[model samples]
Target: MLKINDITNASSAGAFVVKKGFGAILAVTCLLGAACSSQSVEEGGLQPVALKEAATSASTQNVADKPNVLVLMFDDMRFDTFSYRGGPVPTPNIDALAAQSTRFDMAMTTTGLCSPSRAAFFTGRWGHRTGLDDNVALWHSRQTGLKDEEGGIIKRASDAGYYVGYVGKWHLGPNGMAKRGAEFVDTYKKELEEHERQGAPYGRMAQTKRYLAGERDENGEKNQYYLTLKGDYDDTQAAQKVRAGQEMIKSAAKEDRPFFGVISFSQPHPPYRVPEPYASMFPVDEIDEPANYMAKRVNKPLSQEIPWWPWHEVSHMTDNDWRESRAHYYGAIAMLDRAVGEIIQTAKDEGMWDDLHIVFIGDQGSMIGEHGLYDKSAYAYDELMRIPLLVRDPDVEPRVVNRIVSLMDVPVTMAEWMDLKPDGAVDGDSLTPLMLKGDSAITDAEDDALYAYEWYNGAWFGLRAIRTQDYKYVWNPGDERDELYDLKNDPGEIVNQIDNPDYKAKLLSLRKRLELRLVEVEDSSVTRLQRLIELNS
Candidate 1:
C-alpha cells in the first residue's frame, strides 16, 4: 500500500501541494474544490459553448416560458435496484413514473460523492470548478456562497421570473449556498439538530435491528432489515422532507406561479431503518447473494484504510446478515417511493398535472455488496457511478433513451425549455431533442461516453474514471495501480485485464481517449501523466 505521508507530501501530483503540511493541503484542496467548481466554457479552451447545439426546445407547454419544474431526487439510489430493472427490490412508484417519462438507461453523476454531485447538479459544472470536490465541509470555506458564482443557476432562474423554492437536503457546502435566490427555503439542517436533540442519528438507525432481523431468519420466522412494531410510517426523514416539499408545491399552486423546486429525499442512503411493514417487505431467505460475491476479488486492488469498506463489513457478516441489511436497504427505498407517490398523486389530483414537469434522479448510488464492497469508495464501478433518470415534460410523449447522459446536462435542458439562456458557458448538452423528438432524435451529445470522479476524499486516494459503451479506464495516480475493465465481457468488472497481453492495444486506445478527455476537461491531476506512462510500460 502507498504510504499516507507519501500521498500528502507529493507536491507534484497535480491537484495538491502540501506546502505547509497536510493541514494546509486539506485547506487548499477544499478551497480549490469550491472555487474551481463552475466554469463558463469547456476546459483547456476559451471558446464559448453554443447553447444552440442542443435540440431546439420545442416546448410542449402552452406557455413555453413558464412551466412547473419539479426535481424529485433520491440519495444513494443506484440504477439496477429499481424493480423495473429486474432487481429484487420492488419500486412501483418509481416504475410508474418511468412509464410516463423518458427513462435514461445510462445517466451518471460527474462526481460520485454527495456534496460535489449536488453542487455540480445545481451549478451545471464540474466539482473542480466549484471547489466543492470533497464531502468534508471543513475543507471548503464558501465565503461568497454558491449563488455568488457567475454561473449560479438559482439566481439565473429567479432572474427569468420563475418562483424558486429549495427544500430537503442541501449539500452545497457549510455556508448553505443552496439557499440562494429561493423565494422560500427549509433546509435539512434543522431536522439534523432536532434528531440530535431527540437522541437519534438522522441518517442511521441502531445496528441492533439488523441483528434482530438476522436472528429471526435463523429461527425460521422469516427475515427483515428490521421490524419495529411501534415505528411510524410518516415519521421517516424522507417522509418529513417530502411533506415540506409538498407544502411548497401547494403554496406554489395557490399563487399560480411557475415554480422551480428540488424535492430531494435522504433515504436508502444509510441507517437501514425502514418504518412499519417496509422493514419486512422483502423476505430474508429469498434474498440471494450477488453473482460476484466471493468471487476472486483478492487480486483486485482494494482500499485498506476506509472503515466502511465492504470487506470490512463482510468479514464479520454471515450470508443472513448480509441479506438482512440488503433487504432493509431496499425497504428504505420502498418507503421513499411511497413518499414520492404521495408527492406525485397530489399534483395529478389538484388538476395541475398538465403544467407540471418532473425530473426524477438520484444524487448517487451505493455498492450494495457488489465486488465485495459494502458502500461507495474510490472505485469506478457502475454500482456507484450509474443513476436512474426520468424526465417527464407535459408537452412530450414517453420514450426510452439509450444514449449516455450526465447530471451536468440537466440544468442546460431546463434552461432551454424555460427559454432562458445564461451568459456563461456550461459543460452539459441539453436533452431537449430527445425529450421532444423521442429516442431516435440525435443531438450533439450522443451515446459517446461520460467522465466520473470519486473524490469523496481529496487527491489522497481520488480516482478519475472514464466510462464508454464497451470499456472503462480508471487512472489512479502515482503508486496506485490503474484498472481497465472490458465491460463487454466482464460487465461486473470482476477481472483486472490491465496486464493481460491480449488487451494491450485496447488499454492503449482507452488511455489515449482518456488523456484527450482529461485535457478537454482540464484535469490537472498527476494521473494525467501517469496514464500515458502506464500505457507505455
Candidate 2:
C-alpha cells in the first residue's frame, strides 16, 4: 500500500495561483472537450480538473491533480436485473452507464454474500484472507487474530491523500449500530439484550425495533414512519439512505484534496417495503412472473436437499401478493436508480464530471425466484456469482467484454486506470488489456474459470463451482456429489449433466481443473478434508 508522510512545510498558496481568466478558460475548454467526446459527460456536465498540458505543468510546481472516484453500489441487486443485461428492470441510469462504459458480462464474486464479497473487493483478496467468509464469521475471525490486514480500497485511497467517505449500508463488522447474529431467532435475542443493557440503539436489533416501533419522527410528518424493520426492501428507508448518500457526495466534493466516495445503498433485499408513490410504481396485474417461476427441486438432477425458506415462502404467496412484492422490488430498484441519477447530477452540478472515474456494481446479487432461490449464497450458480460491473474512465474505450472476469479485478482495474500500484496480491487480473482490445481477444483468451465459495448459515462447509463459456461444474465437498450444466443448453441451470456418459470424461477434467484452482488460490478447506476422507474410505 502507498503511504504518505506529512509535509509540514507544504505551501497552500501556490495551489490556487492560476491566472484568473486562464483557470476559467481551461475549465470551460476541458468541460466542452469532454462534453463533445462522450455522452457520459454530456449527460452530466461535471468536469473535474482536466489533466491537460497546462494542468500538468501547473501540478509540476507543488500543485496536485488527482481524479475523483465515485463507487455506486447497490445491495441485493441481481446481475440480470439491469436493462442493459436484458433483464426486466428498467434501470436507465445503469443502462446509460453500461452503454458508455466497459461492461463485464461475467464478473464473478469471490463469495456470494454481502460482507465477504465487499471484503474481497476492498482487500483484493478472497474471503478466507479477509476473515469475512460469512456474516457472523467476520466477528469470530476478527477475535482470533484473523483481522482484515488490508484496510480496504477506501483506506488505501485515504492514505494516498484522497478524501474518503462511506455512506449508506456498511455490513462489514462493528455491527453498524446493530447487534449481529442469526436473522430472526438468536440474533434478535442477543440484540435485544444488548439494547436493554445499553439503554439505546446499539446494533441492528435495536435499529430494527426503533425503525419498526416508529420511534423516530419522519420529518415531522404525523403518520409517516421514519424507519422500518423490513430489511432493505423498504423503499421509504431506501430513499432516505439515498438522500443521505447525496449529502455525503456533496461533502466529499468540498474537500481540498481529491475524493473517493462510496455510496452503498441497501434495497431490494427482503420485507418488500416501498413508500407511497414508489411503493405502487408497478401494478400487480402488470407484473410478469420470473421465467422459471414454478420450477421444482425434483425436476433438478442435483436433487435439492437444502430447504430455501424465502423462495418456498414466496412461491406460496398469492398472485396478488407476488405482484405486490414484485412491484415493491422493482420500485426499490427504481429508487436506487434514481439515487444513482442524483449522484451523477450532483457531480455535474459540482463541475467534476469529466475528471472523475465512476464505477457501479452490486455488493451481491439477489435471486428473485431463479431456481427457487431468493437471495445469494455460495451455491456458485450464475445468478449468485455473476454481478454487473461497469467502469467509466474519461479516456477508455466504451465497450462490453463477454469474457469472464471477477469482482476481485475491481481494485486492480481501478489502480491501473489511476496509474497506481495495487495494495495487495490481487486474485484478479486487470481487464484493461481486454477493454482496450475490445471483442477481438475476448473470445481467444483461455480465461480461468470463475470460482466462488461460501461458509454461512450452518448450511455446508463450502460449495465450489467452475464456469466456462458453455459449461459450468459445481462441487459440494461435504456431500461428495457434483453437478454439471451445459450453460448453452440450460442457462437457467434447470438440468444437471454430471451423470451423463457422454460427458463423463469432460466432468472429471473440469473437476480436476476446479480442484487445482482451489489449491492454487488456497481457497479449498473442504477439498483438503474431502481428500483425507477419500483416502480413509
Candidate 3:
C-alpha cells in the first residue's frame, strides 16, 4: 500500500509559494511544461517563480488551446472491479486509463445513494446541505437543481467560456440535467416522457410494480425489468449514453469554445443486463465469493437487518444464485468498459485527448454480498462507500493518492484547475496540492479525514462516519449499534472495536472529529452526538 512517506519529490512537482504582503498561493510548477524549481512558503520565500510564466502563457492562448474537461461516471461500481485493482473483471480500457491517471484508491462518496452523491459531485457541497440527501422519488420532483447564483461546476465552466454538455443520469430531480447550463442536454427525461405519452410503464418504480405483478419477458426472465429494451449492446442504455457523449464531443469540436462534457453510465447498477458475448464472458462457476461474504453482521448497525430491495434480497439467493449474480455484474462492468473505450477513443480522434482533463468515477458503490448484504442500505461499510476515482490531467503527472477523498472534491478540483469561482463556501478541497505535492501538501486537518452520511433507507436511522487511513468510526445517532474499525488491522471491517477497552481512546478521538465535521457542515444529526460527547466529557 502507498503511503504519504513513500512519495518522493519528482523532477516536476508542486509546492506552496507565499509572497510578502500578499496571501499564500499554492502553485503547481513544472507541470506539462519545462521542469521548474518549487519552494515551500513555510521554508521562506524563494527567488524562483513559474506561476507568472505559466499564467502569461495561458493568457496568450486561445479558447481552443485551453484544456477540455470530460467527466465519465459509472453507477454502483465497486472500487476493486477493474484489473488495476486486481479484481475479477478485465476492464482493459479503464485499466489503461488508470495506468496513466492518478488513482484515488480510498475515494468515497458523501452518501451511498445515487442522487445525493451526484448532487455533491456537481455542487461541491454535502448532500444534506443541498437538500438532496436521498434518491429522488416521485415526491422529490421539487428537488430541482443548484440555483444560478449557487454556481455549480457546470455553471462555473459555462461562465468560464467553456461549452458544457451533460448526457445520461442526473438524479437530482425529474429534469435537473436539462435545466443546467449545459449547451447540449440528453437525459432520461425525454425517454420517460415519451414512454408516458405512449401509455407505457416508465421509471424504476413502475417497472418494479410491473415485475411484482408477474410480468415476464419472452425469455421468461423476471429480472429483465431494469432495461427498457434488451436486444443489442448498442441499443442498451449505457451504449446510448456513450453515443450521445461521442456526438456531444464531436459537435463541441466544431465550435470555437473549449468543451466540458459529462457522460454518466447507468449500467452495472442492477439487473446486470449484458447482451451477447459479455453475458457469457464471466463464467459463474469460476466466480468466487467476497472475503466478507455472508460474514456475521454482529456489532453492525440495525439498519442492515433488511435487504435494500425486495426483488434482489440475499435471503432468497442460494450459493449458485449469488455466483450467477456476481458473474452478471462482472459482465455488466466489461460491457461498460467497452463503451468507455469507445467514448475515449472518440475524444482522441477529435484531437481533444492532448488537452483534455479526464475524470472517471463511480457515483457510489454497492454491497455485493459483503456482510450478506445485496444492495446499498443505510450502511457506511467499505463496500458501499469505496468508489473508483481516476483523474488524468494533461498537466499533472500520473500517481496514486493513498489518502481518503470525497466525491464532493470533484467540482472543487475542477474549479481550481479552470480558475472559476464557485457559488459559496464548499466542504470539499482542491486536490491539486495532493496530486502535485503528495502527503506534504495536506496542510489542513480536514484533509486527513473523510466523512460520509446516510439519512434515509426506509427509516431515519442516520449514519455518520469519519474515516482516516488507519481507522474508521461510524456514529449511529439515537441507536446503540455505533461501529469502530481498526482499518490497519482488519481491512475487511469484520471486527468492530467499538466495545474494546483498548480502543476507547481512539473511539473518543474519532467521535470528537466527527462531531466537529458535522458542526462544520451544519448537519442537524450532530445534536445527539454533541450531547453524547458532553456526557462523556
Candidate 4:
C-alpha cells in the first residue's frame, strides 16, 4: 500500500506538495498491479474531433424568435433510472414527455458535482471558468456564487424580451434567482426554513439523527434516511414550487412576450423522503443489487479510499440498508414525476404547449450502490456523469439522439432557439443540428468524445477524464494510479485497465486528448497540476 509520508503547503496558491516518497510508493504499487493484470484491453486511437455545422433552427412555431421555453431541472436523477430507460421505478409523466421530445441518450454534465454543473449549465461555460468548481458548502463559505463570465440563460432570455421565472433549488448561490435575471423567483431555502420553524426540521441528516435516537414518524416506522409526509403532496415544498412555476407560466401567458421559466426540483437528491404511496412504492426485497455492487477497487486508488472517505455515510451500511435507501430514492423520483406532470399540464392548459420548448434534465446523477458507492465522488463513472436529458421542442423532430451532449450545451441551444444574442465565448456546441437532423447531422467523429472533471472533494486531488464511445480514461493527478476502462467489455467500469500493456496506446491517445481539451478550455489547473505530478513522479 502506498503511504503519504508528509503533505506540506507549497505556497499561498493552495497547492500541496506530497513527499517524494509518496510518488515512489505509487510507482512500486503500479508495477505490482501491472504484474497481476492479464486481461487485454482495446487499443483505440483518438481521432480528430469533427464538429457538425449548425443547421437551420427547427422552429415550427410561427414566431420562431419568441417561442415559450420551459426548463425542468432535477437533482441527482440518473438517465438510466427513469422509466423510459427501464429504471427500477416507474416515471410515466417523464416517459410521456420523452415520447414527445428528442431524448439525448448520452447527455453528460461537465462536472458531476451539483453547483459546478449548475454553474456551467447557466453560464454555458466550464465549471473551472466560473470559479465555482466545488459544491455550495465550500464555495459558499468563500462567498462565491455563479460567475457570469458569460450571461446566464435566464438573463439572455429576459434580454430577448421574454418573461423569465426561476423556481425551486438554485444551488449556484444564495439570494433569490433575480441575480440570474428571473422576473419571478422562488427559493427552496425559504420553504425549508419555514418547515424547520414549524417544529419539523426535515432533512436527511436531521431525520437520520432522529432514527438513530429510536424516534419514529407518525406512521410508527423508524425510517433512517427517509420521511413520510402525512398531508397531501401539494402542500409539500417541492409541490408548492411546482405551483409557483405554474403561476409563472400563467403570468407569462398574460404577457405579450414569450415565456422562459425554470422549475428545478430538489427531490430525489437525499433524505429520500416522499409521501405515503411513493414512500412504499418500491419494495425493498424486489430491489436487485447492481451488477457492479461488489466491484473491486484494484488499480483505482480513489475507489479504494471511498470506503473510508470523509463525509460518506455508506461505509457502515449493509446490502439491505442500501436496498432500502435505493427504494426510497426511487420513490422520491416517482413523487417528483407527479409534480412534473402537474407543471407540464399547466403549460398545456395555458395554451403555451405548442410553442413551448420543454427541457427535462437533471443537475447531476447519483451513484445508487454502483461500484459499492453511494452518491457522487471525484470518480468519473457513468452513474455520476450521465444525466436524464429530454428536450421537447415543437419544431424539432421527436427522436432519440445517441450523440454525446453536455449540460453546457443546453443554454446555448436555448439561446439559439429563442434567438437570444450571444453574451461571450461559450464552451459548448449548440444541439440545434442534432435536434433538427438527428444522427445524420454529425458528419464527423470529432465531437464523439466528452470531457468531464472533478477537483473539489479532496484538496488538489483533481480528476480529469476523456470518455469516448468505447472507453474512458481518468487522469488522477495526485493519486497512486490513473484509470482506463474498456466500456465495450466492461460497461459497469468494474475493471481498471490503466496499467495493462494492451491498452498503452489507447491510454496515451486519451491522455493527449484530455491535455488538448484542457488547453482548449484554458484550464490552468491542468498545466499547474500536470507539472506538479510529473515533478513528483
Candidate 5:
C-alpha cells in the first residue's frame, strides 16, 4: 500500500505536483488518514475471520440467505460527470449514495458503444458471444440468429428463489418488452405514431412500450430516437422509464419472494433535450468546456474519420445553442440522480436497504467533448471506456478502490453475493476479493491496460490500449498508427510519444503485454488484427 506521504512526495517531484500549501498539506493528511483507516478495516477490523476465509463461508450460504440484488445502469454517462468527483455537474443524490457505498475509480466497459456494451452486462458474456458487438439497427437478435439465453446475473438470482424483474432500457433484445406489459403490439405501434405526429419525442413509458411493440418510424429509422425526438426530462422518455422502475420495486416488495430488479435509464445521450424545471437546472454561463475540448484529431487512428460535432466544436455553437445543450445534458443527469435517490429511499421505506446489495454502473461512458468526441465507439479514450461503478454490500468494507475493475466482473461478483452458481468461463474475475482486501493482487501497472474494438463502419478495426499510471499507448492495427502519451507529463493526452526513440523498449514491452492479454482472453477478432500486423511484417 502506498502511503499518502509517499504520494505527496512523488507528486512534488513529478511534473504534476501539488504545491506544499497549508490547504494542500491538510488535504493530503486527510486522504492519508482515510486510506489508513480503510486499510485497517480490511486487514482485520471488518470481519473476525480472515478475508479469504470469510468469503468462502459467505459463498457457502444458500441464495435464500444471500442478500437481495438491485442493479441500476445509466446510459451515456461519463465517469467524472458527478459532483462527487469534482465535476461541474451537480448530482447530490448520487453523491449521497457514494458516501454510503464503495466506489471504484477504474471501472471499464468491454465495448464503448451502447448496444454491444449493454448486451455484455445482461448476458455476462462478451459482445462476440452475444452477437451485439455493433450498434447497427439491422442487427437484431432474430436477424443475427441469436437465441434468448439465460446468462445474465438476473437468471442467477431467479434460480436462487428471487423474483427478478428488469425495468428500463432493454437494449439487449425484445425479450423484455412483453414483460413490460403490452397486450397488442399494434396498440403500441399506434401510440408511437400518434406521439410522433404530435411532435413529441416518445415520453418514457410510451417510447419503451412502443419499441417493444416493434414500432419503427415511417422513414425507416433504426433507433427509437428517430421515431420521437429526444424526450424532455420531466415528461421525457428516460424519466418515464425510471418511474416504471420505482413502480416495479413497490410491486416486488408486495411479493413473497426477495426480488432482483434492474433499473436502466437512457439519458445524457445525443438528442440532448430536457423538459422544464430540470432543463433550466444549470445556467448557461456556468457550463464549462472540457480542458481538452478543442483537441483536433490529427494523426490519430479511428478518430480522424469521425466528423467534428458540436460536442467537440462547442466554440462554433452560438452562445444560446451551447447554453441550451449543456443545460439539457446536465438536467438529464440531475433527473437520473433524482430517480436513483427515489429507488434508494424506496428500498429503505420497504425495509430492504440493509438486506440488499445494490450496484450502480453505466453500460459505457460517453465523451462530452473530451478529446473532441461526442458519443462513444470511434475511439478508446478514457472518457469513453471508463465508467462509474458503485457497490454497497454491508458485509464488505466501505472504501474507495483505485484498482482497475471491468464491467465484465459485475455478473460474477453478483453471483457470489447472491450465492448462485457462477458460469466459470467468464473473462472477468469476481471483485469480491478487492471489496474485502481494500487492494488488488494485480498492481496498478498490471491492471492499467484495457482492450476496446469496433467492427462497425466499413471495416473491422481494433485498438489495443495500455493506460499506465504515467503513460498511455494505443495500437491501431488497421491504420498502422500507434499513439503514445506520457500522461504524467501531458494529462490531456495531447502529444504522441510513439516517435520518441527514448521510450522504444517500454512501448515494445507494453505492446507485448497487450498481445498476451488478447491471446489469453481468446479475443479472436483482436487476434485477427495481430495476424494482419504479422502479415504486413
Candidate 6:
C-alpha cells in the first residue's frame, strides 16, 4: 500500500517524499511538511527514489548496516490483552515479543494520550505538530522536538552512530528529554518520586483488601500498603521498568555502541498494580464484556452522555468490581509480561536477540469500561485508539500486518530502519514499504482517513478524528453532538450514528473527509464542522 506517489508529487518538490499511501501521505506530508524548511539542498532529505518493486518483492533493500534498536514503550496498553488477543491476559513477555514479531493487526495512536502519543512517537509529528492537548505544551514544542530545524528520532539516532538509551516515562519533555540522545538516560522522575514516597504505588492494595487493611503510614517504614504478594515481584512498577531495562542493556553491551534502547513502561496504567501470578490471574466471570459495556447513546456528547468518574460509576460496579478491574488489568499485563520477560532476557543475555530491532508499542489504547468510559479523554474510540505494534525487523519474516498503522509510524519506522535521514519534512512515511509488503494493503487500501487530534482536556476538549475502516468521524469542536461510527457494525463504538438516517450520506462523506484532513493538518477544526453544517442545514 505504499503509493502516496511522492506525497502529491513531493508537494511540488518543496519536499515530503515516501509516496504510496501511508494514510494518503500522512495528510499530504503533514500538509506540506512545513515546506521542508525552505527547500533547496536537493529538495531536502531525499533518498526514497521510488519502488513498486516487482523482481519477486520481499526486501529491506539490501540491508544497510544499523540494526540495534529496542523501544518497548507500553503504558495504557489495549488490543484486548495482547499475545495478539488470545485474551484472559497472560502475555508471556508479549507472547515472546509476538513470536519473532510483526504483529500489528490495525494499529493506531495518533492521539490517545501520554503526551500526545509520545509526541507522535518521538517526533514524526501529529497533534497539530505536538501542541494541542499538551504534554507540557508538547515538551515546549519546536514542533514536537529535536528542533534546530528538526532531526528527531534521538537526533537522528545520535548522529547515525547509535548508542542512545532513554529509560522510562518522560511524559513528553524532561527538559526536551534531557536534550535527546545520551549514551544512557533516565526519566524515572526520581525513582517515581521515591516510589510514591515509599507507599510503593499503594502496593496494589496489598493484593486487594480494597484499601486500609494493614496499610501503614505516618512515620511508618513498610508503608507501601504491603506488597501485593505472589512473591512481591521486586515491588512492582513493572519491576522498576524491568530494572531500567536491565541497566540499559548492560550499559549498551559494555559500550560497544550500536544501541538505541528506550524501555519506557508505566504499566497497564493507573494504580492497577500487578505481580502474584499476575495478581491471581484473570477471573471476574472470565473478564469479557465491552460490547460497549453498558452502552448508551442519545447522540452521545456532553462528554459522552455524562461518563466521567468510574465511568459515572458503572452502574455501581460489582461482579467484584468488574472482576477486580479485570484482574488488575490482566495483572498489569502479567506484570508487564514480567517486565517484558526481563527485557527480552536482557536481550537474549546480551547476545542481542538475533539482529535485535525489537519494537513493541502502545502509548495509548484503553477504555477499560468502554462507552461508560472513565479516563482517556478526547475520544476517538477503538478502545481509546488502537496500539500494539510489534516489529522485529532483522530484515523481516514473521508476519500478520492487517495494516492500519500509525503511532506516527514510530519515528519514521526508526528513520527507515537506520538508513537515517532526518533533517526536514517529517510528517511520517515509513513502514518500510508496508513492512516489506507483508499484507492487508497496509496503506491506501483506502482507510484514506486516519488523523487524530484532541486538545488536552479543556476548551470542551476540542477533538478531531477521521478513522476509516468502515467509518468513524468524531468532531466535537467544543461539543454539539458530532460523531458517527459503524466500524463494520459497531466495533464497540456503541452507537452514535451522527443523526442517523441511514447515515446521511455517510455523514457527509465523513464531513468532507474531515475537511480535507483538517486542511492537511494546518487545521482549525474546520469551523467546528462548519457550525454543525450551518445549524443542521
Error of 1 at 58 (Å): 27
TM-score each candidate. 0.77, 0.73, 0.80, 0.80, 0.74, 0.33
Identify the candidate with maximal TM-score.
3
Residue-wise lDDT of candidate 5 within 1-537, one digit each (tens)? 101111121111111100000000000000000000111100111100000000011122244444567777776677887898887777887898777677887887777766566666655676555655654232111222123453555555555666565544444333332332211111011111111111111233343454456554344331212112232333444444444556656666665555566655545554354445665678768777766774776667755554322123223334344445556667667767776776677777766776567677877766655564545555667777788888777766678888878887777777666666664356677777788786665676567646566554223556666666666777776676788888777777777777788887777667766777677667675666566446533
lDDT tens readout by residue for model 4, 237-282 = 4565565667767776676556677766655664455666776788
Clashing pairs in 4: 49-446, 50-446
Which regions of candidate 2 fall more than 4 Å away from where they truly are? 1-63, 137-148, 175-235, 299-316, 419-422, 442-445, 524-537
lDDT of each: 0.56, 0.51, 0.62, 0.61, 0.53, 0.55
In each prediction, how many residue pairs overlap at the backbone (N, C-alpha, C within less than 3 A)? 17, 9, 0, 2, 2, 10
Judging by TM-score, tell me the better candidate of 5 and 6: 5
Q: Rank the candidates by TM-score, best first.
A: 3, 4, 1, 5, 2, 6
Model 6 residue 419 lDDT score: 69
Better of 3 and 4 by lDDT: 3
Q: Can you write out model 6's per-residue Cα lDDT over 90-144, one digit (the tens) per residue?
A: 5676676677777777877777766667766776776564453443322112222
Q: Best-fitting candidate, measured by lDDT?
A: 3
Give the per-residue lDDT of model 2 (tens digit) for 274-305: 45555656776887886565466443424244
Question: By TM-score, how accurate is candidate 5?
Answer: 0.74
Tell me the lDDT of model 6 at 260. Answer: 71
Error in Å for residue 450 of model 5: 2.3
Q: What is the lDDT of residue 406 in candidate 4?
A: 76
Backbone steric clashes in candidate 4, count: 2
